[model samples]
Target: MRKNYLLGMALMASLSFYSCDKEVIYVQDGNGVESVADGAQIITLQVENGGDGLATRAGRPLYSAEAKQTIENVKLWICDNTGKVVYVKEISNWNTDGSTVYTTGGHGRQTTIELKDMDKLAAGSYKVYAVGYSNSSDYVLTDVTNVAEDGNFSENMVLSLSNTVGEEIFAGQMEFTVETGKGFKKPIVLNRQVAGAFAYVKDIPFMEGAKYLKLVASAQNQSLVLGNFNSVDLAGNGSGNDANVKYVVNGENGKSGSETYEISSIDLNEWFTAIKDENGDNLIDAGDNWKNPYSSEGHPTFQKGSAFGGEFVIPFAHVDGKQTLTLQLTNAGGNVLRSWKVNLRSSDEQLDQTITCWNSVSTDWSTEVTDESANIYSLVRNHLYGIGTRMNDDPGEGTDPEPNPSDPDDQPESLNNKQELVLKVNDNWEVIHGMELD
Candidate 1:
């Protein structure tokens, strides 16, 4: 009788649905509820009749089944213990067999969702909710489960150096080693994304002597490592190296030193140009001072008694632009070797100057300068005069040649017109045998 009544009602509704444009109303408790308008219908969702429940693991697949009736759009979401939605998926079509599987008409289908990287998901309980909506109504269903038994472990570690700029030391190649406890497996090297973050898959086997491991981080083309973790001794022994290994932090121990220099009154621009040696050849080349007209056979040679000294020329064009200039030096290991700051003062008149060092051979290792006026600078090594320059002169426009008592090729003492600035170690201005510029 119930079947007959349902069949009779379906027949009456189908017939009364008459005009294709006429809406089909649903009456509840004899109160006629407005029928859903054309293109309007409620969507409902629930676990599929024969579908399996949701299952997940750390490294396992995420599985879930859902049923949707022509109600509306269907969406599924997975949320963490904190109620934060971690995953969302949309279902567009849900159809099977000839008969509509969904309780609502026009909707029919069952679907299984898949998820990965479950191990990255935090260990805790989570919830999955399915929402269905159509023009007329909506439906929601939810399920909750514990994720602790997902069998995936977290393997993350943070690495840092006492020095803030340590990671930037070796042209960006920082190497480090890992140690796992005995019986623990070595973790899989995943990725090093941040300055101090490294991710690994827990997997390496930990041997007895693996209590501590040493790793050397080095830069390419460099002979020495930028940094090393030598005292990272593990406290426990384990079968597989877990990502949660504790590190025995220690103080940073490495090579350190410094360099210093003194500067006389000079134009800020000229002072900076004097030190700009971009090629790092240890000599001031033609390009060093764009306005200076001079060329050398090659990079300047710096050593005791070498004609090509390390003294550099100051261009007259740059003066009174700024005040103080400082140069910073770093060793191959990125350690601050030294920094020199020079105070610049306005000169009464453009004066010729000379800077001298007492010891010649030891200058290269100890003497280096940078132009704080500009970031222009260079390193002088093993040469008596690392840089030097003379006023640009026409090939043959100078006065009468010098009548030297010995060599005619040499200009006369009075007519020796070459105006050159010479930088020497421990030499005084009076001992300077160069011509005076007007």
Candidate 2:
């Protein structure tokens, strides 16, 4: 059963931004109007998904195996000019796990979300702030019921990064007007709100009696709030210095996960495989562009036809500075073999043949980077970064056993820089939406 979400219940909505037939569809009564419980005619918004919703498709990068467009619930706030939240409505459980299916001729799921409160307010201009999220519990609820014009709405209602990691945060804001008789009819396309960062572990040979590999992405905390803003992040607020938010991949055999702590990992042994050619050859491709991205002769490439490995992803709120990813290549006895500082902003043009570095991270995690072939320092919402690496026939170094994790003969090993692991983006990673932090 769908729970009652709206405290001051007024409207209901089901929207799909990218649709086929029509942008919006209204399945109304014979009178051509949805009658509300309070008899305040419904302001309808109809939408449907048109293919761009789920990003996981053929030839997509490994980390593309995530939910790009899945909005479970939405919280709406209709605020007046002075930021006074005059009306509030929460729509719960719209499209989830094929649970509710109101389709449009099988193109994609059709959605209809209705609005109320027009029967009370006078005709005027209003700002509609809508936030959609997958997990309801992650939202930091601030009562917008009686917010004052003295910036109370902006301070109270917000979404934080502490709990929303790897979760869906779809948000949108639109300005609309309400006439004397016509309630309110406007479309809200609540798109993804968090920037996507994913890491791929490839070309790492299953050698050296290696039992496990641990990968951790450490970033500054997302302490800012999503308060009546399109996105979060103060320009120079030092959010990039918090160094607390993290995404980890510790799965066995080079597997991956999407949790805050031990969210997911890779199975190292099962993660890597030699690229192949059409003539039943391994580590070779027909086009010659697929396999050898860096050098046609230096080392072999990873990711065969069927699958790839260590597809780790972290959904993050926009932080201020460059993020750090610490990779611990361990042996069977939990010995630290080697460390790597991944340059998430590794050149993407070699992958897409279009743009230079697009992310906006300053310093590399393990080793600081001065300049790059491509660099978009800041992480923005609705972007994707598919980052990967290549490990050659070198066994690098190793440390003593862990628990009391020791170094190689009490010797500390430096992290392998991104320039060493990744020379250029692979052709397989076609769409470079965004980049990892470091």
Candidate 3:
């Protein structure tokens, strides 16, 4: 059934007979109760969000899968030509019996709004503004007394991997002139003002005895102000050209092996574009502002060799097209040994795809066979970087063993006095043909 309501002059007298179910009331006329069109004019509005539901790169829903995230209520503000609000009305899922039922079914479907009472709309141009919430606690409506006195509306939409509950907010506006009898044609669609991101590091060589391994991005540790819906710096400051904005340290001790780190919380709209000052100012205008021109739709895919290095799917609320992201492999002391500057493609290809590190120098690692199915690309790189030799002997020349075993005397004669360069991945030693100590 079409939920209709009698608004304007009749609202005051009709409130005396309010019902607990919060159903719309019939507009009363001088003669008696009249049906819609028999007396009062009706204004219809349609509201919709972009798709069924926004989600993370891992395919997890951002809003409630059941569409319950959208609260069944909206607040409307009618303003005159001068932009001053004249009237305010809040239509909610209130029930006279105190048992409330709401518009809570449908995944990504448009909802409707109907307002009756053309009498309040004089013969002039007027503006109608509406705001709704996905969850009640996420936002609050205030002020809204009269045109001269308007209240402040607060908004809170938090997006993070850890956040499973939906907290989305939608808003729209329309302009219409009050005619003797006319209806609105166009509908309104609310735009989402936020984006999400997650990342994982794979096959990054951990520096041995280097304290700890840490993953650092060009933009990290930065907070974005939610009120500003449009800005190039929302993704981050181009400061990636100067200093790293964020860093996450691995809890495990640094050892020689292939490392993987996963993080699921990144706000694309949180702009941190200023060159971070030494004093660490949290204000948005505290430093030199350089806008980041990258869109949040894509993320960097890091690969040290043929294997995947790291995969990141970062989102942005604004900006468009391909974006550049830099991934760095840093030691606990803040030393970046290897970094990959990846240009993330615009589309689902950015999700669940592995990009090989184009700079990898392990041409022969693929041809070498190991006792176990392990990749020793990292081991070969470490050996060549240390010995100043481009190649090592075949597997028969020597044995590749773990360094500093419990019994030092049990070491092989061919391995004595030679620094052992070992590569480990998936808890197995990946012996390279030319990496054995001789």
Best by TM-score, which number? Answer: 2
TM-score of 3: 0.34
List per-prediction Cα lDDT, in the order shown.
Answer: 0.18, 0.31, 0.24
Count of steric clashes across candidates, in order:
46, 35, 17
Clashes of 3: 17
Candidate 2 similarity to native, TM-score? 0.48
Residues 1-438 of candidate 2: C-alpha lDDT, one tens digit per residue: 001111000000000000000011112221233234432434322222311111232111222312213445556666777777776655555455422333322112223444433425566887666555444434344443234333435532333333323333444465666666654334443333333333344334223555455544443333223322222111111112112211111011112233323222333434323223345433223232333231232322223211122321223222124333445556757666665543334433222222121122321112222222333132223333333321111112222111121211111111223323221111011112223323
- In terms of lDDT, model 2 sits at 0.31
Q: CA RMSD for every model?
A: 34.2, 15.9, 24.5
Query: What is the per-residue lDDT of model 1 for residues 104-148, given as tens digits with 9 covering 90 to 100?
Result: 221123332323334223334543333322222111111211112
Query: Tens digits of per-residue lDDT for model 3 on 1-438?
Result: 112222100000000000000001111121123344422334332222111022332222221001112335445565677766666666564122211322221012232334445434555786555444332332222322121324333222122322322123333454556655543332222222222111221122333322222222222211111221110110111111112111111011112232222212222112224223333332123223322211133221111110111111121111122111223434445466444332221121112222111111332112221111111111110000010111111111222212122222121112112322211110000010111211
> After superposition on all CA atoms, how large is the RMSD of candidate 3?
24.5
How well does model 1 score by local distance difference test?
0.18
Candidate 1 Cα deviation (angstroms), residue 152: 25
